[model samples]
Target: MMILDQFYAENFGKVYRSCGNCGTQFKRIVQINDLWAVNGDVVAGINTNFGDTATIRTTQVDGVDDICVKYTGNSNGAEPVEIGSGPDTKNCLYSTSDIKQL
Candidate 1:
């Protein structure tokens, strides 16, 4: 079976999406194009609107947006050694002597 699913987001002209489980602000639309594919009545008196590409959305956790930053941490068995803005900065997973997160 072929399943063609699309997110029907109709507004007076507009967006933000929510999560299912946590119910927090999960998705926020930065830009939206109402007309992904508008032929503008190309063939006779019919306006063909074909959707192209996919809808891409993003989420913000604890107001963390910057993905490129440095992570440095020191953990002497205290507070689990939190890193880089508290698990939001990019490349926070990697650990090393120079760029280490404790």
Candidate 2:
């Protein structure tokens, strides 16, 4: 699974907004395409959306929309969560707005 360090390096100036149980600030990030992290809980990709639990609505961070975002959620965890994944993991749409470009 793609760790936070690599994700951060590739997608600089981005922060996970949801403060889950860990609340480690920038320590954890959820890769929606894989569902590796959920509601702040870090887990391996189960190939399931877990029932569309999370959703990131529209919000502004430093007044920006287009930021460091990858086109697809393949290997790199830089893709915008909004772009979503396949049917198997489509429901689990985490808030892309929470991931802001600093």
Candidate 3:
């Protein structure tokens, strides 16, 4: 499995992974296990499902170098789907089965 996207806060984070060929997505919610720095970048230690709470590491990168995710607003009377942590966060990434946002 490879990471598709990730979002992190101080206490917790969510990593999204995709299974190869099958196009299945999995979300892993994790708490901070440890932290360190490498080459001026901060790396986070998180738990994974790869064999008994396997630890995985990640470093925060510049968002300008990453793909842009679509953000939606709830002004058009269409119900905005909750994709991020909650509605308060106002962060969403979604796609519908029909010809809609992706």
Candidate 4:
């Protein structure tokens, strides 16, 4: 696994990586000021995943804006669909079958 900080210096940037075993293409976006819980501390964690396509959105809550991630994929028409969506503070997981929006 690769640390998010290694790929992005700030949030709101695109990251590209390919699976070594399957050569599956993956893309990720990092949003700034993303909140994450690691080791009981709510610090900014690098949010990322692997997939074929992705979309990102930003919302304002209580006068503060936040970013969200959404991804979808079906690798070569395989079984199991992956979808993930979540705030910038959390990490997401994806599989080859489908996109997982966290």
* The best candidate in terms of TM-score: 4
Task: List, residue by residue over 38-102, the lDDT tens digit for candidate 1.
Answer: 11110001001111111222211122222122212222322222122212222222112212111
Candidate 3: segments with Cα more than 4 A from true spot: 1-22, 40-102
* Model 4 misplacement above 4 A: 6-13, 16-68, 77-84, 88-102
The per-model lDDT (C-alpha) reads: 0.20, 0.29, 0.24, 0.29
Residue 27 CA error for candidate 4 (Å)?
A: 13
Write one digit per residue (lDDT tens) for candidate 3, span 1-92.
Answer: 23323434232222322121223323323322222222221222211221111123333423211111222223234433322221111222
| 1-102: candidate 2 lDDT, tens digit per residue | 222332212222333323222212132234433211212212112212122132333322333333222211222333224342312224334445444333
On lDDT, the stronger of 3 and 4 is 4
Give TM per candidate. Answer: 0.14, 0.20, 0.20, 0.24
| Per-residue alpha-carbon lDDT of candidate 4 for residues 12-102, written as tens digits (9 for 90 to 100) | 3323222213335444343322222112211122223443222222211221122233433334544323243443323533222221113
Clashing pairs in 2: 56-95
Between 1 and 3, whose lDDT is larger? 3
RMSDs, each prediction?
20.0, 13.0, 15.5, 12.5
Cα deviation at 32, candidate 2, in Å, is 11
Q: Which pairs in model 1 have colliding backbones?
A: 73-102, 81-102
lDDT over C-alpha atoms for residue 9 of model 4: 24
Q: What is the RMSD of candidate 4? A: 12.5
